[model samples]
Target: MLTITATLRCQGGHEDVLRDALLDVARHVAAHEPDTIGFFVSQDLADPCIFTTYERFADQAAMDRHNTSAALARCFATISPILDGDVVLLTGTELSAKT
Candidate 1:
C-alpha cells in the first residue's frame, strides 16, 4: 500500500473556504477513486486555519492516478490563492495499519 500525509495552512480569513474545499475534494475522491483506500481530512482545534489529511492508496499506480486527477488540479486551483504557504506533504510505503 502507499500512503500520503499533507498539511495545509490557510490565510487567516479563509479558514471556512479552505475547509469546505478540502471536504469537497474528499467527497469527490470517495465517489470517483475506487483505488483510493482511504481519505481522511482533519482540522486543528487550536488553529482553525490549519488542516491535515491522511490518504491511503492500493498501490503506486493508484497514487499516480490521484496525482494526475483533474479533481486534484481543480482543488489546488481553488485553494492556492488562499493558502498561507505551499502544502506540506509526505508520501511513503505503508508497513502497517490499524484497520
Candidate 2:
C-alpha cells in the first residue's frame, strides 16, 4: 500500500474555504476512485488554519492516477489561491497494520 500525508496552512481568512474544497475532493474520490483506499482531512486544534490530509492507495499507479485526476485538479484550482504556501507531503510504504 502507498501512504501519503500532506500538511497545509490556509491563507488568512480562507480556512473554511480550503476545508470545503478538500471535502469536495474527498467526496469525488470516494465516488470515483476505486484504488484509493482512504482519504481523510483534518484541522489542527492548536492552529485551526493548519490542515492535514492522509491518503492511502493500492499502489504507485493509484497514486499517479490520483495526481492526474480531474477531481484533484479542480480541488487545487479552488485551494491554491487560498493556501499560504506549498503543501507539505510525506510518502511511505506501509509495513504493518491491524485495521
Candidate 3:
C-alpha cells in the first residue's frame, strides 16, 4: 500500500473553508477513485487551522492517479489562496495490520 500524510496550514480564519474543501475532496476520491483505500481529514486541536490528510492507496499507480485527478486539482486551487504555505506531504510505508 502507498500511504500519504499531508499537513496543511491554512491562513487564519480560513480553517472552515479549508475543511469544507477537504471534505469535498474526500467525497470525490471515495466516489471516483477505485484504488483509494482510505482518505481522512482532521484538524489539530492546538492549531485549528492546521489540517492533516491521511490517505491510503492500493499502489504507486493509484497515488499517481490521485495526483492527476480533477478533484485534487480543484481542491488545490480552492485552498491555495487561503494557505499560509505549501502543504507538507510525507510519504511512508504502512506498517500496521488492517482489520
Candidate 4:
C-alpha cells in the first residue's frame, strides 16, 4: 500500500475557498478512482489556514494515476493561486494496518 500526506496553507482570506476545492477533489477521487482506498481531509483546530490531506492507494501505479488525473489538475488550478507556500508532501509504504 502507498500513503501520501500533504499539508497546504491557504493565503489570507482564502481558507474557505481552498477547503471547498479540496472537498471537490475528494469527491472526484471517490467517484473515479477505485484504487484509492482512502481520502481524508481535515483543518487545523488552531490555525484555520492549515489543511491536511491523507490519501491511501493500492500501489505506486494507483498513486501515479491519481497524480495525473484530470481531477487532480483541476484541484491544482483551484488551489495554486490561493496557496500561501509550496505544498508539503510526505509519502511512504504502509508497514502495518488494523483497518
lDDT of 3 by residue, 65-87 (tens): 99899999999999999999988
In model 2, what are the clashing residue pairs, if there are any?
Answer: none
lDDT of 3: 0.93
Q: Give per-model TM-scores.
A: 0.95, 0.94, 0.94, 0.95
lDDT of 2 by residue, 1-99 (tens): 999899999977998898998899899889999999999999999988999999999999999998899988998998888889889999999777667
Question: What RMSD, rounded to one decimal, does every model reach?
Answer: 0.8, 1.0, 1.0, 0.9
Give me the runs in candidate 4 sitting further than 4 Å from their true place: none
Instruction: State the C-alpha lDDT per candidate.
Output: 0.92, 0.90, 0.93, 0.93
lDDT of 1 by residue, 1-99 (tens): 899999999999999889888888899899999999999999999999999999999998999998898888888999999999889999988899899
Q: After aligning candidate 1 to the native by TM-score, how far in Å is the CA of 88 from where it should be?
A: 0.7
> What lDDT score is found at residue 19 in candidate 2?
90
Please, what's the RMSD in Å of model 4?
A: 0.9
TM-score (C-alpha, index-matched) for candidate 1: 0.95
Q: What's the CA RMSD of model 3 in angstroms?
A: 1.0
CA error at residue 44 for candidate 1, angstroms:
0.6
What would the per-residue lDDT of candidate 4 be over residues 1-99, giving only the tens digit for each residue?
A: 899999999988999999998999899989999999999999999999999999999999889999999988998999899999999999998788778
Q: Assess the local accuracy of residue 29 in candidate 1 as a C-alpha lDDT between 0 and 100.
A: 91
Clashing pairs in 1: none
